[model samples]
Target: MKNTLLICLFVFAALSCKAQNIIPVEDFFDYQNEIPDGTYIKDINNVLNKFTGTWLGSYDNKNYEIVVEEVVYQSQIRTSLTYDQLHLRYKITDANGTILLNTLPLPDDNDYVAMGQYVNPSGAYQLDYAGYEYDCGQSGTLFIKTFNDNTQMKLYLYLGESPYNEDDCPNGFAEQEFPTNSQMLLTKQ
Candidate 1:
């Protein structure tokens, strides 16, 4: 009887603890009470303007450039391709005058914007090139140092896995034995 009673009490205690652990969605975020001063907002805008110009650089002997055509704060998501919930959008182009990529500013929902593909696996958000999908892995400490305001370089340190999937290379893709590294350099256009 005592054992049964103890079990019931334990279950009740566990249920109680679980109930206490749950947090209401409404209470998850605490809204800020005060608005920012005008000067502070202006300073932020100035800093943003610094990031709004064209940047140019090179990586792996391939020249690249990016033109920040538009900057939007608190941007709304009209569509997935055009000005979604991103802070900014920079029209990117390569040296050969080919449209290479698009740079979207960081999203409020995520901790980091897909910055030059240092930490994305599926390569869904990375700049795609012919025959090679660059910057598509979870990056380590060395990856962060490659990023700079003027010239951004991303290195996909391929340990051993094939960068191309079976669908990409169907002719029985050869297994990679050594670590391969690919670099992408972005400069403001």
Candidate 2:
């Protein structure tokens, strides 16, 4: 009788612990018709794993260094859903080795940090980018595509124009440290 009671208690305890439902990262949008409130959208195929690491590149005499990392169970921007996403931090330096812009020291939640949004049908990864100068229209969508056996990637920025009062700018808008509407090749370091 005592053994049976212990078994029942153990089963009850096991049942009491709720496990989170896991959905493959690729299937995130397919479930839009029915919202899976607390499900985890994960990279079960390890696609994003290959992109996690340091990438180095250069453009117009400026050196760019980006670090990619996977963040698991990150809460969605405006919902109860959680998912695994890529986090990007970068540092740009001038030809003379002077720092132009650096976001490596910022926290993951900082506005300057780029957050992964989704992968498109063409297998290109998209991320929401907000630079330190976002208030002046330095924010946009960033696209990354892996190539050459995942050792190289192409980074492109599509700047989204933000509406700001004309009076805010006395000397006009400053050019982005990174390229806008163009792509740069990066090699995994």
Candidate 3:
């Protein structure tokens, strides 16, 4: 009887450990509750659909303009948008035809995660690389206005202070006030 009880306790402990590691799908869908009942939901989906492609833009800092290109692709229906940002040097491709400076795949799966910001109907948000969770502290709205089938404009607004502002790298850049608009001209490939 004692041996059986010990085995049960060990099983219970093991299950508890596994539960701690499990991330529920609901956590990632927290933004769903913020969506309005009617028209807003469809509007969100429309904006997200427009985001599926390659976007190229430049950030000018007086003297130097860094040409940045971002390639975004949707995963399976429920999967998060996976993307990579590359510096457009002389040529775009790496030795293996992959984009240069591509982000390494996350350990959870063989998928590359985007750095900087990601905006969906759920809201403008930032993903935590170390913990692999959607951070509530970095919430904002990404307003995307479609001009046509080929042209769209994006405005990213951080509702509050940006969580990344404290760091010194890309993750640490300061959040701009509302209407920090950036335009992208996408040529579907």
Candidate 4:
């Protein structure tokens, strides 16, 4: 009797470990109910591959250099769900070649690094952006859309007015960091 019980318990444990459900990244939000624990929103189709790599662009005499990389993350707060996501880093410099803001060298887990949220219905990827100047409220959503066979891309940054007052700004009115509303063309390198 003891030997039979042990074998049954082992089989059940093995089955439970394989019970995780894998869903395509695009269809993740379509689920009706709250996603169960241990569900994976995977990029099984490699839809995010085209956006990975370095991209460069310029606007208003400032050069923008961005890097996008994909990563797999497991969420402890969201019931241990695992998913694929993108992380972005950027460097902006003035026409005179003066460095303005650079998050390129920061560690991957840095708060200032823009983290990809999801792919929009228009196929553009949206990222949550928060610059180091957040005290002055330099934060917003950034969208990236690829074109010309993924060789070229467009970046649109939509930002809101600062919630902080002048007194909160040690720099005395934070200069807008990125181009707002207008889409800037970027080339993949």
Candidate 5:
């Protein structure tokens, strides 16, 4: 009789407590429930974020320092914006500490920048922009390869411009040869 009475009293107390305040159980399988309010998720893209920063390297007896500045991705869809475009400006000085190449853009030049970005998930970002020459001819392409957790980078420039000496040769150039063919290995500074 005492055991039955005790069981009945325990059941009554549990029912009364549940009736006082109730808490809804979250569904464990729901994806949205896992993320709490006032938090966000970043879209991890294999593009500009990894490659943008100051990098140091050397090529042709010159020490090079380049900055991969991120530019806004202007798209029709507002939600799809990211640091997709990049301005790969650099400052290359000779071993003697004399400046050889410094094309680093000023901060105010955001209206019209140098380079645009194309994605390469496997290795690098294919950048299409005007050649780094005042009068080479026209536009060109830059292949910026990155590795080692964005600590290392390699830049290969393939300029698509014609020779000014059209009269001297009288024949077209056999292959695509740039006046300034360059390859650089750089590390993030």
Candidate 6:
């Protein structure tokens, strides 16, 4: 009888722990739909405006430039939080006046706006770029941070170890035995 009682208590404790760990259904779909309401809302514009104008950088012995503008995005998906998220729109170009990047991934999409700083105070105002693809898996994340005071900007691109799922890798898309230029450094133009 004592053994059965102990087993019952153990089962109850296990079930209680499981119930505590079960997250709510909505918590699983925690997507960044829009900027959350906060006390620092007023300062967001000034921070965003700092990204405007032209910034230059280089990759693969070639030159590139980024242009930022504050504009009104068309209001679509009326009920969605991202329907009219106000922020800086970026345009990237090369020396020969070739469009280098867009919002979506493309052959020439070397740079584009990824997202905005949601929490502001200690959040990252990040961007994504096709940091110079040697093979299929050639994407990287560019972090924008305060370079020389609040006026200037510094852009750093970090290429993770994971390459594309291309058939180039003999053993399931692994990195080759060559030096991969995994980091890019740039300053505001």
Cα deviation of 172 in candidate 1 (Å)? 10
Candidate with the larger lDDT of 3 and 5? 5
Error of 4 at 174 (Å): 2.9
Instruction: Supply the global lDDT for candidate 2.
Output: 0.81
Error of 4 at 103 (Å): 0.9
Alpha-carbon runs more than 4 Å astray in model 4? 1-20, 160-163, 170-173
Clashing pairs in 6: 137-164
Greater-lDDT candidate between 4 and 5? 4
Residues 91-187 of candidate 1: C-alpha lDDT, one tens digit per residue: 3455566655444453433322222221223211222111123223322211212245534434233342325466655554543211146544444
Candidates 1 and 5 compared: the better one by TM-score is 5
Model 1: residues >4 Å from true position, as ranges?
Answer: 1-44, 73-165, 168-189
Per-residue CA lDDT of model 3 for 1-189, tens digit only, reads: 999999999999988865543322223344433422221111222334444444433222111111223333333443433333111211123334554333333322322232323443444333322112123233343333334564443433334433443333345443331234553332333
**Number of the predicted model whose lDDT against the real structure is largest:** 4
**CA-lDDT, candidates in order:** 0.34, 0.81, 0.34, 0.83, 0.57, 0.43
Report the backbone clash tally of model 5.
0
Q: Model 5 — which ten-residue stretch has the worst lDDT?
A: 21-30
Q: Give the per-residue lDDT of model 2 (tens digit) for 29-74.
A: 6675575666667788887887889999999899999999999645
lDDT at 25, model 2 = 71
TM-score of candidate 5 versus the correct structure, residues matched by position: 0.56
- After superposing candidate 5, which stretches have Cα over 4 Å from the reference? 1-46, 73-83, 105-113, 131-134, 137-139, 162-182
Query: What lDDT score goes with residue 28 in model 5?
Result: 14
Q: Could you tell me how far off, in angstroms, the CA of residue 167 lies in candidate 6 after the best superposition?
A: 2.9
Global lDDT for candidate 6?
0.43
Q: Using alpha carbons, what is the TM-score of model 4?
A: 0.83
For residues 59-144, what per-residue lDDT tens digits would candidate 5 score against the true structure? Answer: 66778777887665433434433333667776768789998656675552432235644554455666654533323343467778
Better of 5 and 6 by TM-score: 5
Question: How well is each residue in 21-61 modelled by candidate 6, as lDDT tens digits?
Answer: 43321231243453332211223234455555666566654
